[model samples]
Target: MVKMFLDFVGDKFSASNPIPVPDNDPLDDCSAISHGTHVAGIIAANAIGISQPGFIPDVPFLGVAPEATLGAC
Candidate 1:
């Protein structure tokens, strides 16, 4: 579902993780675009794996409100 939404948006919403020079750390290509997804995950992720930037796989993203409904315009 995440991949589908990303593909559907195409260039409109860029979530490309880029590694920069010197520091050699990954940067959020578009934080504004990422913010919404992060918020949504916190609300209704429903047993999502923790592959996010700083999170550990063993500590997954258990939703704050797993039974919550989500909507978007």
Candidate 2:
């Protein structure tokens, strides 16, 4: 059941490839793509088998809901 959910969400919103932004301009030289990628990582970091320590000691840094689906506008 968990595997199915992961597969479905992964297929729908995998961030392995770069997603295009509507506007190519950045505000004050700040890249919107960079910000978006950071936010996305916070929302869905699938840390199922990672052994490295995350931002917090001993605890793996994972998203609020690793299996949750995500979409960018």
lDDT (C-alpha, whole model) for all candidates:
0.52, 0.52
* Full-model lDDT, candidate 1: 0.52
Residues 1-73, model 2: lDDT tens digits: 1221112222223366445333332222335568876887888887655666444445556798777766543
lDDT of 1 by residue, 1-73 (tens): 2221222332333346343233222232455566767888788876665466666666755678887666432
Top model number, TM-score: 2
lDDT of 2 at 54: 42
Which residue pairs clash in candidate 1? none
The ten-residue window of minimal lDDT in model 1 covers 1-10
